[model samples]
Target: MTITPLHFVGVSALLFGIGLLVVLTRRNAIGVLMGIELMLNAVNVQLVTFDRVYGPERLDGQLFSLFVITVAAAEAVVGLALILAVYRSRGTVAVDDLHELRG
Candidate 1:
């Protein structure tokens, strides 16, 4: 069994495009957060693909990907917390509607 770098790049590109579309089109804070996550996952896929293709010589990419995943998880927690706080304070999760900073 073999996987080509082109395939990984194509998948990563697709995921990145989808994430970009989501970020551009969504108004909800949670939806925007999900877009950011998708973008991060796309980058992770590229990192893992490069690591696998380059063997031991490219271990740093995989290690960085692991760190990225960890950071992404922490970001999700913190981002959700902020979103909740914003919702409580603003009474809405729409990014445009949160301008007043008041509920």
Candidate 2:
């Protein structure tokens, strides 16, 4: 069977849902970050699929995906750094234990 745009959208929605579930259920900082990445990738997939359907001659979707990747990479770096620092100081990466930072 040949794949269609609907297939891509279905897969993207599934991926986004999985990522949202992970983000909501995960306690570890790294796990949450991973979930965010998954969500971002899902969005990228949707962008590309729509671009293909609407205007295959343009590179807008690919360009936007690339920008998202760059932002995601930077976010990962900063998030990891914060997580590392918190783990070093607090001895845990659990979200519940981070309330100590609250004023």
Candidate 3:
């Protein structure tokens, strides 16, 4: 069978679902970051897929995806820095361990 927009959407949904699951269940900071990244990628895929189906000439979807990628990069850097700081202080990267940061 030939690949279609529906297929892309399906895969995107699956990836998003898996990412959400990871975010909900994982206790590690790094794992949760990875899940967020996965969810972003799924959104990128859907954006491109819909753009392709609508009209590839405009390339609006590609541009939006690029913007998202830039944001994701910034998020990763900031997130990793915070995670590292937490790990340095607590000696653990678990999300639950971060409660100590509260006043």
Candidate 4:
């Protein structure tokens, strides 16, 4: 009864799938950003799992995961800022309400 890397991979896959679904189905920009964050977290989990299972001597996997985390943070900040700006201008955050680009 021990945890394994395979279990982490399976969970990561499930999270990625759910994240993808959320990104695809949600009309709100914030919801889509949340999905993207979930997907990024799944990737971080896989990176850490693989590092623990195979690359204990090297910190490459963990380092990469940290980089991903940093990027995800940056993305969330910038994305939320943009969403806020849009909402302020349009009065709604619905994706469908953003029809100013119809050309």
Q: Which stretches of candidate 4 lie over 4 Å from their true place?
A: none
> Judged by lDDT against the true structure, how good is candidate 3?
0.93
**Backbone clash pairs in model 1 (N, Cα, C under 3 Å; residues 3+ apart or in different chains), count:** 0
**What is candidate 1's lDDT per residue for 1-103, written digit by digit as tens?**
6768989999999998899899999999999999999999999999989888888865978998999999999999999999999889778899888665567
Clashes of each: 0, 0, 0, 0
Determine the backbone clash count of candidate 2.
0
For candidate 4, the lDDT comes to 0.92
- Cα TM-score per model: 0.88, 0.92, 0.92, 0.93
Q: In lDDT terms, which candidate is top?
A: 2
- TM-score of model number 3: 0.92
Clashing pairs in 3: none
TM-score: model 2 vs. ground truth: 0.92
The best-first sequence of candidates by lDDT reads 2, 3, 4, 1
TM-score winner between candidates 1 and 4: 4
Model 4 over residues 14-93: C-alpha lDDT tens digits? 99999999999999989999999999999999999999887568988999999999999999999999999998888888
lDDT of 3 at 6: 94
Model 3: residues >4 Å from true position, as ranges? Answer: 101-103
